[model samples]
Target: MIPNVIRRVEFQYCKLHFLLRTRPLSHVMYSGSTGLVTPVADPSLLDCSRAAAQDVDGFAIISNFVSSEEEEQLMVDIRRTLRGRKYLYDHWDGAIEGYSETEKSNWSESNTPVIQRLKAVAAAAVTDKVVVPLEQVHVLDLAEDGHIKPHVDSVKFCGEVICGISLLSDSVMQLQHEEYPDRWIHALLSRFSLYIMRGVIRYKYTHAIPTNENSVFKGERITKQRRVSVISRTQPVHS
Candidate 1:
């Protein structure tokens, strides 16, 4: 009869060999010290269909939120407003890089209509409770090479709902689960699109805008350009 230790080792070796043959080398992790081969859990392992089927709560994107003409006009307004302003590379919060940000409590005559429309869209997206847009809106200008790192918004600043309208250029936003790195999804923020994040998406996922080098969506490469976003937040209602 075969010794128990030998039998166990033989079984493990067969299992390892089977896994190495069936799976891609990129999916396997080898430990040099223990001579063990383990399968790595990566988001890429799951196909796009399966990942899209996951019940992601409180995340929605509205494509073509504004007309082409309206988008052009809005871009002009943004450029004029931010012209000649010095951008901050080192922010106190350390949330952004190569970015220029300012707060807009009031919109100009040409820009007020867009702000009102954004508020309306935001109000309709979140149905649980009424979300009042704060007087101050966040205007961010991302440089051509800039990117936002993965991070969750501070609870002290905003409430449950966060609304943002992407303008000027197209890009992809990646939201990864805070607890499980392998669970992630990418949302394409096309020009003039509005994205809403609330509840689980707002609190549980760390959202980021990767650089052009690593930007991808649904297996297609994405080339990022200078983008601008007008972000609005609801008042903080602490329980």
Candidate 2:
């Protein structure tokens, strides 16, 4: 049993695992095992659980979010567009986090072709009136052993949803509920795949990429390839 101060409850068994949390706590729940279900007794947990279960009505998955060929071209274009730009910060080797404020100041008025194309792609995804155009976006590149610490995006962003498109390689993205820290949901992000996370899944859970030098999925430790991610969100962005 693992209890999280932030409203996560976790139960783990030899072949199963369970996670639970609330909205104020981060709306994601991850389950790894098959049986032995338990009811959430905490009032805060119950509130979040209810919200998460209810929020699934609008969930969407856009597989083949980007094509490998398009991703390759985009990488080249972004690199060229970003050349000599001072706002690009190295969050990790081969990974840069773009600042929206800075980007707006430096590139928004440029009318660059690549930027225009990107905007078009973003526009297509914002079909719902409630889903506004993402004001901020970030790009991440990961090589072998590269990873991010488990964390939830800051709530101040008012970001009700997060959309991520994979550009290269295939990797696993893990989401864990603070309630059930030991249990997790692993999503394989294939090149060109698009994943949209919202509702409880977006706000209530912590997400991360493990830093194992050689990660074993299923039974093999395949070398990691250079991978890029385009993260789109509505913001008041925060670190």
Worst-scoring 10-residue span by lDDT in model 1? 41-50
**Candidate 2: 10-residue stretch with minimal lDDT:** 9-18
lDDT of 1 by residue, 119-179 (tens): 5444444554776777888889998788898899998888877888888888888888788
Clashes of 2: 13
In candidate 1, the residue pairs with backbone N, CA or C atoms under 3 Å apart (3 or more residues apart, or in different chains) clash, namely: none
**Maximum-lDDT candidate:** 1
- How does candidate 1 score on lDDT? 0.69
Candidate 1: misplaced stretches above 4 Å? 1-54
Off by over 4 Å in 2: 1-61, 82-129, 212-214, 218-222, 236-239
Tens digit of per-residue lDDT, candidate 2, span 1-239: 11231122112211111222212212222111322323222222112233344443223333454445556666775566555644433453332233211223123222233233233333333233334435545665555446666677777754666666667677666566667544445555556655556655666677666555534454454344666676666544354
TM-score of each: 0.74, 0.55
Per-candidate Cα lDDT values, in order, are 0.69, 0.45
